[model samples]
Target: MTGALAVAEKVPEPLSKAKTNIVFATIVLGMLLAALDQTIVSTALPTIVADLGEAGRMAWVVTAYLLAEAVATALAGKLGDLFGRKLIFQLSALIFIVGSMIAGLANGMTLLIIARGIQGFGAGGLMVTAMALIADTIPLRQRGKYQGALGAVFGVTTVIGPTLGGLFTDHASWRWCFYVNVPVAVIMIAMAARTIPRMRAVVKPIIDYAGIGLVAAGVSCLILGLEWGGQEYPWGSPMIIGLFAAAVVLLATFVAVELQAREPMLPMGLFRSRVFTVCSILSFIVGFAMLGSMTYLPAYLQYVNGVSATVSGVRTLPLVVGLFVTSIISGQVVGQTGRYKYFPIVGTLVMALGLYLMSTMGRTTSVWLESLYMLVLGLGLGLTMQVLTIVVQNTVPYAQLGTATSGVAFFRTVGSAFGTAIFGTLYTDQIGPNLTDALMQVRVVSPEVAANPQSLRALPTEVSAPIIDAYADSIDHVFLWVVPVALAGFVVAWFLKEVPLRDSARAGATDVGEGFSMPEPSDRLVYLERAVSDTMRKARAEGPVAPRILADAGSDLSRGEAWALGQVYLHTRIRGAATLDAIAEVHKLPDEVIEPIYDRVIGRGFLTEDAGGLRLTDTGRAEVDRIRASWQRWLGARLDDWDCSDPADRALLDQALANIAAKILDEQAREQEVAHV
Candidate 1:
């Protein structure tokens, strides 16, 4: 017990200013790299295909990287909790560097795709680990600012990626795209090694191999179905339908497996927390629209507006600017004010409006109008995303920090993948026929060619121009379709309760002093005492005293209560001693509350209280002695129970209990000596 008390006393506070800044730097820089990589490659891909002589296999480059990265992210978080954060982060950096090397060295599409997969794995670690690290080091009060900063960086990266990619692709080789990670990775690794301490390993962790397999399989099937839809097969094709069914089954099994596991990979109990559950729902919706919108914007700009990759990149800047401004300001405000419930409510509404505006784009849409819509989208995202993460981290205990943080990242990534795929399918379903009919009517496509859906992209500009416009228009319709989906996020946000945010120092002190479990209020204890007294008195009644019952009742009463009454009896008797009237005087309690308990005492034969006074018979005295003997034995047993497995806690509780017991024994011995005298 003492050791437990000591451990409770030693809970560490939040990181210092230097550490907080480093953590903030780590999160923002890492997020910038992740978000930038996703957009940067899109602008450079055309150049990549032209140089590598394989436009046919271009989509695989993006697909391969995303698949690999998504798979690695889910596990990296668990690894962080089980092993150590420092090792996982450092290893992720090294892996990214090596992947970067491979990508830079690649001479063909095949080699580059393979290398991209490796890079994805490392990128996955970076994304999840950075988020987890932020939760670990920052206090809730200030975490919003840091999380918001990351969101801002993500926005900046979105705008910069295309421009930077275009610049690199136009002036330098496409290889610089991968090479950019080198210096960033080096800096991140160095800083993290210095700032982040190595976390101790858990005593034992039960790896949910079955759950991992099920979730991986389910996600893979779903992603593959979405990826292949519209492009490869009809939406209702047997293969697609089968894959969807398999996804549902596998995910269901994963949930069931998690429940049965002793130490689950993803704790089922986390779902019970309202904050975690709601935040996860919000994340999924954000992922769906956020990734879907991003995927199509560059394509629309380059394909329909007839702009250069650099210009297309510039066009996306308004959204990023809005996001950056909102995130930074909201973060500081949230940290200072310590309230986060309102951000999500406002953010989801803004996001819905942004999506609605995005759905209205057209071939004839003005550039300024497009920028206005992007700004709305950016503003909405800035408010909700990071704030949701803060709420989750605050609701859970410290030990589950890594797991909880990683889970958020995993859901976000999976949502992004699913969203991108669904929107891709929607765009394809609407565009294919519209493009063919328009080309045919314009007399640019022959009847034979118009009938063949696959040959439309190969047609000349006269045929393809109207067709591309149709594709862009249909794609905008898909974005419109998702407006409701984005709005649905608002429903989740509305349920988010306002929880009190604790500073890291105060949070640590609470963990050591009390615990994550909420303490009962004093008023409730007073009510409980009254209830107990009422229940005990009404339940027991005084009747003809049963000898056996009296004996048992006396055994239940403590020696302290008996001694208190005995002293009162002797004191009152001495005041009227000359008569020796064969009477005992005892403290009398009012009948209204005390009569029932007093009746039980008499019925049990522990004591008889009448007009004369209360008296303890021979059996009552013997029962008291028996009760004391049994109580002593129970006290001895409690010492062992208090000696927990933790040596420090055991030593502390042991010493304290031993000291108290010795004092008790000393008092008993001194009283015996006085009686003998």
Candidate 2:
């Protein structure tokens, strides 16, 4: 049959506001749970190591999750396609709860690290599936707005995580760090089951199993080496040497696998685009700066400032405020004007300045001074972080869109892993020697008391003075070393050529989520729809694409006439009937608003309202098909550049185009204006 709504099979029927809210709530919760975990363990890490007695390996508490989450993110999209988005989403939540319980129950560092990994794996699934679910179920007209809100959750979580973690650690126990996820996730799961549609992806995304394993092992080896070197073992030790060697070999192998894989997770081809290349580099450093700082800043607060976990979390607010303020502002500015090349350059440079300022913090630094420094760093991060994803999306080919977007995120996560490990290494290497010298002046400082920030703070001022200085100096050491990394990003940012952002970005498509750098999965079709919508809206290409082709197709119908026919056709095709009432309900407008359109179509003999329901006449059906074919030709003309050498690839691309053509409903006004109401 010549389908009128073939493109809409991928998108579920539009939901009522109540239903949308329910679905949106579930998506936001899933995303919050995942993104929150990325940094939530920060404030709790100090107390966890004190309780577990593996101070040297504390970084793994955060690193294990990041590394595992990175690996899981690579697979989540494909996995969702293979099974079902809702199923994968629920399973991911279950896995996360299980990991959380295990982490909370664990008595040793080894078991805790493994549990965190389990949690990270689950978190990754939650993050990616949440994004895919949005594309799968939400109406295309409203998708960008929701995506942006989800991104805001990520930015808010960066601040919330540390504070919430600290609250649990100070008032309750460090184990509650992971335990907290259980209740929230349980609620999300229940809500998801009820609200999220159970639909499987028609297109089977190629899963790079070997590539996932290779990258997982490679990144793991690399992170483990960074975390372990000069702390658990000497940098030159056989174990450390082997880890780095394995990392090099495995990563090199992973790159080789990507080059050959049918659908590589991080396509080697993406680097050819100057924007992708520079954005990837800057993204890594952004994650490095953001996550790395959040992970350890609590330790500096607790030990150096003699603040409790909860207080330390609050103290970090200046940084969060800076991040939120700039992140939002940058997004708006970029949306108004398509220019964005200057953000990364200025942002990275400011980040370096922030890091340099932070390096000067010591035992004598006041809380207010520390906050100012943190705010500066946050401003720098806010400026640099949000623009990369937007620019890269605009720059990369539509075919490689999904891969490139995910690639930017992958680099950022990996960068976070590296940053945390390096931070831990610097702090660990410095603290021991620095403390040994400082403690030499004190007669008897208990090792246990010295390690526990709370216990050490209980000591007399003079007695705790040396330990505080040691802690302060150690943190300062990390900030000082990391300044160079931020500077490198600044250097790379200069090479990032400004690609004009699509109208979608100007329409606020990427404002919330992309700016804050959410761990979003790639869905090229969804993105393309938004971009096209934005372009049309910006150019005043109002109404439907069908009218533009009607002139060429020689259709007699007016723009509203085409829209009326298209809507009735889609409605009848999907629900087996179309009615004025049904159209009003679906669009959430009144009968009066919809009756005018239906009156014209029925009067024109295109549609008939019978006892059974609304039916499209033969003429109406033919016009719809002709309009669809014209759209197909239009798409084909623009998409011929895609390398579809393989018949299977060609079929997939053709089908996608056809669906897109059909999906472009001959509607009235704009989806944005209607959907918003």
Candidate 3:
């Protein structure tokens, strides 16, 4: 953390400005690849099913990717910390490239679903590691601007993904959607290899293997039960019931495991906070409403309204724009005033109203009406989704911040998966009966044409009427069923506690990018570093930092002595010895400029000079340690208001601050990374 560190820490010299730009660009590309893939398949699904011919299994394309991505995101950060962020990032990109190739070539639904799952796993790593790498590489003072830019990428790409997918499906082929990531990923990998520096965690990261496994397995089982119910099996069939039972048992076990786990993947204690608990539920509902609508709207437009894939995507813009605009507005308003209890309360109610309105659509519903319905749903979701993480950040203990933020994201992703699965089950169950009944009444309409929307659309208006009506009814029912879920969220939102926002959290309240939440974990040390940076940013706004810091330290040294001592200590670690000439050369100065400082340092008995250049005396090393301790004390005073009263939590916060202090003091003092090659 920083108090003096704001003006005190040197710019880590490993990266020049050019190198930082190249590294940031590469990270943005990889993150884009991961985020873009999430919604890219939505508009393409109808076309993909037309080619692959397993319409019933269509939702699996979306669900498989989501579940796989969830697991990968949960584990990727720890994996990066344990190994190295750069290597893991490259590996993730490679995995994604390979998965894309397989999906592009797959000849059957089973193979395609498997390939999509692989792609999702890689995408997860790309997203989480890319975010972590920013922490590794970016300077503290500039991290927020960079992080906000990355968040904006998610929002912008989200708005475009469905439309881009539709264009590819219509112009080239549905497979091109997967094929496109390959070349982009290759370029990202190549640039990253040359430009990004290698970095690893300062300490071993804890991975909750059992918790991750149990939750993944349990969620998968639950998804399968919902997906298969009423289609391949009856709701009460042995197989469906078994899946549900296994899900409940596994999830319960996962909860038990997390409760006992040291540094649990999701600390059970976070749910004890009313804000965190309520926000998590609201996040799940927003995800359910948002994704469920995004995934199915294309079907209604393409099948019932007889629009092409590209046009269907274009029509969905209202929803995306509504979401984007409202999220920005809500984030800005909430940031200005620390009050946010009513956003979710109002949001859920609006979401329920929107879904109910959409559920009333028939085959003849006007395009304008459809767009308005979509817009309402989007606005509701946007308002609700953006604030949940911020609220959790404001209320959770400093030690639990990382897990709580990620925990809310986790619930959102899982909710999206569940929503798609449930919506698919509802559609599959209803569509068959409605189609079968229509086939009897309209014998001239063949089953084959009915299965393909493109073929059915070419038929005479009279012949296609009944079939289109059937598709509309099925989609309408899916929305009708989900309205209750949104209403449930409305009931839950009433329980949200409006905690006053922390000053650090309040600083970014107006950031539009903050509304675009992704399932990425925060590093506790990195977050603490940002918090201190915020303090310094405000301090810099007020006046000078160094004088205040010096007054606080009350040490018997001038700024030059401290700067000289720090450089000498750092030089000895890097270059084996710090000669006056080498120090002068490194700073691009003459010996005349450095000689006097060296003589003063030598005269004080803090440095020893000989043929070995210069080395810190034991006394000098202690002085360096003293500066570090001062930094720690300054950091502690600033964080006194942090809610970590439990002795264990307080200890963790202190340890995190100490680590931050050491990092600030040392900056980038890595031994040469031969492994990077």
Candidate 4:
């Protein structure tokens, strides 16, 4: 994980730009469907209710879709890590088209809900696979712009969803809401099948079944509790309480199970990263506020404000427009400058301000004013939302990219669910009594309307206005509550320490601040110092650390030559393979120079050479063995640098070098093996 494999200088010549674009377009279209489906159903609910006669089950339509999607997101990311993104993506597209067809042709509400769940599953795969593939294709430096384009796609889809839903429901049929996916999915599937290059699967990790079970059980229970508690059951109902308790136990068991597993679904080491932990927290908070608020906003516009579905669709444009502009700008800035900490800092602050501004809205407040508030909030969200993903991915090594990114996505979904439930409760508690009071004043309430609070919206204007006003008041309070959550996100954004974005191909090759070359070793000075020290140690009353005071200093070379040559004699002596006195004579030096080399070599008993010169003694051979052993240890410590297949062999080579060094000195060879493998 520490070292990166070097990338080829360019992609293979056989790959064409047209093929690459086709692949890219497929991913984009898939992502568009996922983002659009999240909001599209809200605009078509009325028509769906009239056809199916299940207005009471309306919330489940969206809840079931989201719940299925959330599970698929994490699962798809894991599958891509084990298999290949191209394969999973193609399969997901096929599943999506099939689900869309089923939903479009369904007769009953139950069947349609099940079909939506299937559609949600496909959406999840589409999102995770699309994002992960982008990372694989693009370099980190250029990825920001591509990620920005994804954000733009999401923004456009969010605005388009409601409008498209209204057009389908008003002019044709509510079934088109489901059918619209067919053609787009078919195109995307064909594009993907034609363009994405085939790849073999990686060696799969040992599957941790117990950990998977606990995670699935835990998240499912928790999400169900949030989705059902306020609407289908009371807050303190036994079923709700039991589900919450089950979630806690299952989640705790998941952690324990993963810790014990040899190959964990979620690696515990990921938590060791401070930035990853903080990013997960921020993602959760953002999801909680964004998804939860967006879920009920359409209801407020239609049921509370007497607006048609088309008008509500048009009115939400400001939010999407704000997101589009800010997302693109932030992406460009982050890519060019390589400094992104400030965007989130500024964004979270503005988001909190916008939430605070939204809390001030009343039933009679100006429509433009509300739009302005949403626009501000959307812009702030756009800047911060994707930036955290960038920071988290940047903090980890490339092999774990899909896992880390999906982990953030999973936490965000949890936050969104919790946010929706809490706000749902707050709205119900505040609106119910105010609605009753408003109806009493109008004096036209029926038993059914009183019993089913949802029916109050269909009453005459005189009877419904006051009740709708109460909804506006309560929803504003929900926004007021969200301000604090947004503020907490701002605090979380503060701790992200910006590390330099390194190019993956060059990650472990060299220090970025310096050029690629390593300095050559200077062994001449090492031998010179060793010789001088040995001479002094051997001399009982040596004058100084000078070379001549000791005997054996010029055993092969003459004193005069040793004296004149000084330290330069060490390199010359070794190269010539000469005796101590002969080397000294050749350089025309005194014992002072060559004496050091002779004394040191003799003392260490490692001066190996031929009969033509002084050779290593038995003790010198042992010393060489010790040096080789030390070198082997040094190389062993850096085994992580070796690739999977090479580590054991590299360690063996290091040990072999050590043995060779030792054997040469032991045999007192005239020629020594220095540092060869």
Against the true structure, whose TM-score is highest?
A: 3
- Lowest lDDT sum, 10 consecutive residues, model 3, at 668-677
Put down candidate 2 lDDT per residue, 1-677, tens digits, no spaces: 11112224654666877898899899889889898888788888888878888787888888889999998898887788778889999999999999999999999999999999999999999999988787776665566677777777877888788899888998999888888899999999999989888887655667889999998998888888888787778889999999999999999998999899877778888878787888888989998998899888999999999899998888888888998888878888888787888888999989999999999998888878999999999999999987887787776766677778889999999999888888888888998898888788785887788889989988999999988998899989999999999988888988989755655556663365556776766666655666644554444445545456777678887666776777777777667787788877876778886677678888888888888878888977888888777766765654454445657546666666666555555333325335423
Rate residue 627 of model 4 by lDDT. 40
The candidate with the higher TM-score, 1 or 4, is 4
**Candidate 4 Cα RMSD (Å):** 17.9
Better of 1 and 3 by TM-score: 3
Candidate models: Cα lDDT each:
0.60, 0.80, 0.81, 0.60
Question: Which runs in model 4 stand beyond 4 Å of their true positions?
Answer: 1-13, 46-59, 80-87, 105-112, 131-151, 190-197, 205-212, 332-339, 397-399, 428-437, 443-461, 498-677
Cα lDDT over the full model 2:
0.80
Ten residues in a row with the worst lDDT in model 1?
Answer: 513-522
Query: RMSD to native for every prediction?
Result: 19.2, 4.1, 4.8, 17.9
Q: Residues 545-650, candidate 4: write the lDDT tens digits.
A: 2222113122343322223222222333334444566544543446465465556555544455566555545654343334445434432332223222445434
Query: Which pairs clash in model 3?
Result: none
Model 2 clashing residue pairs (backbone)? 151-513
Clashes of each: 10, 1, 0, 24
Report the alpha-carbon TM-score of model 2 versus the true structure: 0.89
